[model samples]
Target: MLSTAAVSWKEPNVECSIDIGLCPNIKYKHKTAQRRLTLFEDFVAFGGVCVSWRLVMAALKKDFNMLPRVPWLMLAEKDDGSNLRDFYCPMKCKNIYRSMLPKASGKRFFSSQGWLLTIAADHEVNLLHPLSRVQILLPNLTTFSNLEEMATHCTDKLYHNFIQKAVLSSSPSTTSDYAIMVIHGAISKLAFYRRGDNAWTTIETWLSAYSDVIYHEGRFYAIDCWGRIVVCDVNGSCPTRGQIMPVMPNEFTHSLEKLYLVESLGKLLIVLRQGVTTRDDYTHGTTRLRVFELNWEEVQSLGNRALFLGFNSSFSVEASNEIKANCIYFTDDCFEAYYSASFADEGAPNYHPEGGGKDMGIFNLSDGSIEPHFRGRSFDPLSPPMWVTPSF
Candidate 1:
């Protein structure tokens, strides 16, 4: 139970109401008084972690641009690594649990239709509603494992290297809708999950491509390693078995490292990242950020933009470098992107020679500049991680 106190403020011909929550001296806008009153009165847990509570309220004001109205407690992974615990934030905190799922390392969450799709390690996927915590696991199951004998025999591990990238998308078919995931390893595999039936089906081919999966215009599309942009007609009644249609005018191939899909200007936009060539003098390294229209006609590079920070200006032009990308995220408006500096090539001698510029940063395409945000671990190790949506 939370004890409550109210403070009334009066100024020259002005009056206001300040409703108190667990935090002291906290004031609320008078017009939204009822909401503020409810938050503190209804949800304050005396024994809860105070830092988490304050952090949640601060995040709500910063990210959502809304005042803390009602304190809504949510289940979250504790910063102390104590599994899951109940913590409260302003009622409007969006998808609080979504970021926690990855740390749990038990289920993965993908968002669609205002619900989240959660898949266990075994590929047992479930659809969950974030607020209500309602879940329905899809019945279909697909498991991938490398051959034990071959894995053990080979000095270099290749089996676990089956697919370098995995993404999920929901496509509408004439009969119904399904979730399509593109798995790219030594082989390219398209796996489909039928809703209501809870089953998974896979189609394999020698596309041997690494690309980002994009859901657009009721279909799924990707630019393969060969720079061939392929689009699959998801509306097909049966499992996708026919030839995939090519929509791009020219085959554009690059050592694409990252893929991002954004729906903009009434069409789909694909952003691809390719390694920059080093000059013979080895003065600077280059990376390309390519944007393609849905029709795959006009492809343009953002021009020497360092998509990942650590690789900027360090490598010799002629030398080959495998750029690693940490996590990639986009703002809600999709006009900007934020990527982590850590790459996959941590062991390479010249890797991140610049000490990995910043842990995380923000990029605004409008200005073509990146603002780095560096937070030391001691600041707030358990500060709630950003948005994690439950799968439904």
Candidate 2:
């Protein structure tokens, strides 16, 4: 007959089994012994590999709970002449964070891995984490000898004439051995810099006028205005061009307003934005948003993911049931037609002078439909709305 203690062991949380009818049976002893032996075998199997199976389970639960509930989109606007206010996603809420940038003249050029890449008026690049108020300053713009030559080429606006975008290989919090790549020069040259490097090294490539650059799979890939992709190895003193991706479709290369490269789900994607020139300004009036996955010799569909495009950064995430797949969320910048060149002196190339027509919204890829995300808020031209993925 099984003992009362053994019966209690069979009930995980019960202090004791009250069923006297089954507890006194000798068969119950065999069942309880077999169950205990199975549990012991499991513990013995996993014990050699880890300190405790319980601890591993606890650590996994903690990590799963730490995942963000929802990603947020970030927008920057001028509160006064010098101060900038940051608005979080789902704009109806009162949650807004302010920038810690010392100079109001700074412009945001890139955002990734929970950092905002900004260029100050004095031509210093800084990485700022708005949520944590952490910042890192890279080597100054004049440190690059090639950039100095490019500056002399356009002496009137030396600082503003170069550096369209910059991207980092990894987050500074993760490792100290990170690299930075920038699309610089009037003709769109690629420049590379590592954490310990003294100056930026310009990569040699056949393509001219790059629209965007992204660091993916331990290397940097850039897309030119004509939708050509070039690969660069950043390990060398100067980046070496590795291979050019397959030529983009004629529809993507012709009349392209802007090109963006984003890494999602272990695949590289190119976002081609096409718009029409309206009067003196460019209006994205019926502009089509097309996303293509870059294969070895051809392009494919994006498949079940939504892309967010901005001047500083572009990213993709799996679409939930609520948010349909194959759609794009975008923000207005200098590439859009409503942007005026007269606002260039107002601080940063993206800054808007009139502070109207931020043109922020979502576009559906399945069907041609556009939905505006923000309705009543007015944003600064210099600090237009941008999509920011929240990270710690």
Top-TM-score structure, candidate number: 2
Q: How many residue pairs clash in each candidate at the backbone level?
A: 27, 6
RMSD of each: 12.0, 13.5
**Model 2 agreement with the true structure over 267-350: per-residue lDDT tens digits:** 888877665334334333436777667742334455787787766566777776334477787776543344445345455454
Model 2 compared with the native: what TM-score?
0.72
What lDDT does candidate 1 reach at residue 84?
Answer: 45
Judged by whole-model lDDT over C-alpha atoms, candidate 2 comes out at 0.59
* lDDT of model 1, residue 297: 57
Q: Candidate 2: which stretches are off by over 4 Å?
A: 1-66, 81-84, 91-105, 152-161, 236-238, 249-252, 276-286, 295-301, 321-324, 335-340, 344-352, 355-357
lDDT of each: 0.35, 0.59
Candidate 1 Cα deviation (angstroms), residue 93:
12
lDDT at residue 34 of model 2 (Cα atoms): 19
